[model samples]
Target chain A: MNGVHDLGGSDGHGPINPEPNEPVFHAEWEKRVFGMFLPVAACGYFNLDEFRHAIERMGAPSYLNTSYYEHWLHAFETLLVEKGALSAAELAARQQQIAEEAR
Target chain B: MASSAHTRPLSEVEIRVKALESLLVEKGLIDLAAVDALIDKYEHKVGPRNGARVVARAWVDPAYKARLLSHGTEAIAELGYTGMQGEDMVVVENTPEVHNVLVCTLCSCYPWPTLGLPPVWYKSAPYRSRVVIDPRGVLQEFGLQLPESTEVRVWDSTSEVRYMVLPERPPGTEHLSEDELAALVTRDAMIGVTKVSA
Candidate 1:
């Protein structure tokens, strides 16, 4: 499926802000997400295309608001549910735990 | 006493990753240890520095540059950098007459081995969508201002192939050695979002 992830020449996205001495990753969560996404992806539930499509499959509000790795995070949830490894209810509960803990 | 890691709450993505990782690991679907190692490799090793080495080598060796432009995979593999998403590499050279920039209109199909993980902007919706439509305007945003006579070619990478930009070597830098030249090559230069200069 051609998703929003494919942004080859549309418009309205803003300027690119580059950092001096940029690091490979900025945050700890980013690293964990990348590590998990890549290996689980290699585990064969879906090919690269399927994985990307899962990201594309996200609702517009969530997709537009999410960061890059957040897209990967949402995709992980989507793939797990789609592949029968997870359920929407379970993901919702996990998200709730963090939300409640932060309260 | 607990470490700082415990005091700080994980981000939403981090929390989800932890939850998913535990679930996946419990199902015997993935090896957490191995995943950690892979992240370490990308974080510490196999980064833009690796691509910088390639750019530097090409700058010093004309034949190698020719081979790189013609057979990107083999030339890159010669440097011992080869893997998924980069198996079919296409090295486009940025010259005085033409400038080459890379974007994955479909998704961020970047060369992981050479450039490491793409920048946030590379994966952001704006960069993905805007670069192809108005490369000159986008170039201006990236601080690259090319003359009208110079052609800006934006390569839209598909799943079949990935691309890397070979930036033009700046003038008066001939005295620098191959390693030094490579040192000057930035990831943006390689992506054709910017240039390499002294």
Candidate 2:
């Protein structure tokens, strides 16, 4: 599906501002999430292509607005639930628990 | 930084990923230790330095360079940089008349073993969307200005194959050893976003 992720040769994306000497992972949490990607995918929840497709399917506005790993996390959720490894209800409940804990 | 529109935490994706990770681990769909190993590999054992060594070896050894150009995956694996995104590596050289810049277009498909994870901009809509149509303009933004006559080939990685740019070595460096040459090879040069400086 030709989703929003295919932005090659388009416009309105400003500059490619590169940080001099970027760290492998920006933060500890980023590392954790980034780390989770390959293992979960390796479990047969979804192949690499489906995960990429899921990121592409993130809907243009949201796709452009979200961060890179956020896209990954979203795709992970979409596939996990779609593949029956987890359900939307369970995910929502987890989110609720997280929200309450944060308060 | 503040989270994106949808909040997951200060990082936006952290807590959600943790949530997903815990559930997956609980269900035996994934293992935390394996995930740690994956991160450790990319974070410590692999990176642009590995790619720099490859480029430097190609710079010094003609035979190795030929082998690299002909069979990138095998040549790269020769140096032990072989894994997920490194499976189908294609080495593109930047010559006086041509430059090769890579973009996934669809998603941030990158050669992880050699390049490590891509920078945020590499996975950004701006780089992805504009690089193909306006290669020169994008290169200019990256502070790389080429002659008007030069050819810019935008390798839109629409598949599993990944590309690495062999930047033209700078002049006046005959005394430098392979390690010294490797030190001069920047990640941006390998990505074709900038030139390797002294």
lDDT (Cα atoms) of all candidates against the true structure = 0.84, 0.83
Pairs clashing in candidate 1?
A6-B105, A6-B106, A7-B128, A7-B129, A9-B129, A9-B133
DockQ of each: 0.56, 0.58
TM-score of each: 0.92, 0.92
- Least well predicted 10-residue stretch by lDDT in candidate 1 chain B: B1-10
Per-residue error at B138 for model 1, in Å?
Answer: 1.4
| Runs off by more than 4 Å, candidate 1 | A1-3, A93-103, B1-6
lDDT by residue for model 1 over B156-183, one digit each (tens)?
8888898999899999998999888888
> What's the C-alpha lDDT at position A102 in model 2?
52
For residue A48, what is the lDDT in candidate 1? 80
Query: Candidate 1 falls in which docking quality class?
Result: medium
Instruction: Supply the global lDDT for candidate 2.
Output: 0.83
Top-DockQ candidate index? 2
Relative to the true structure, candidate 2 reaches a TM of 0.92
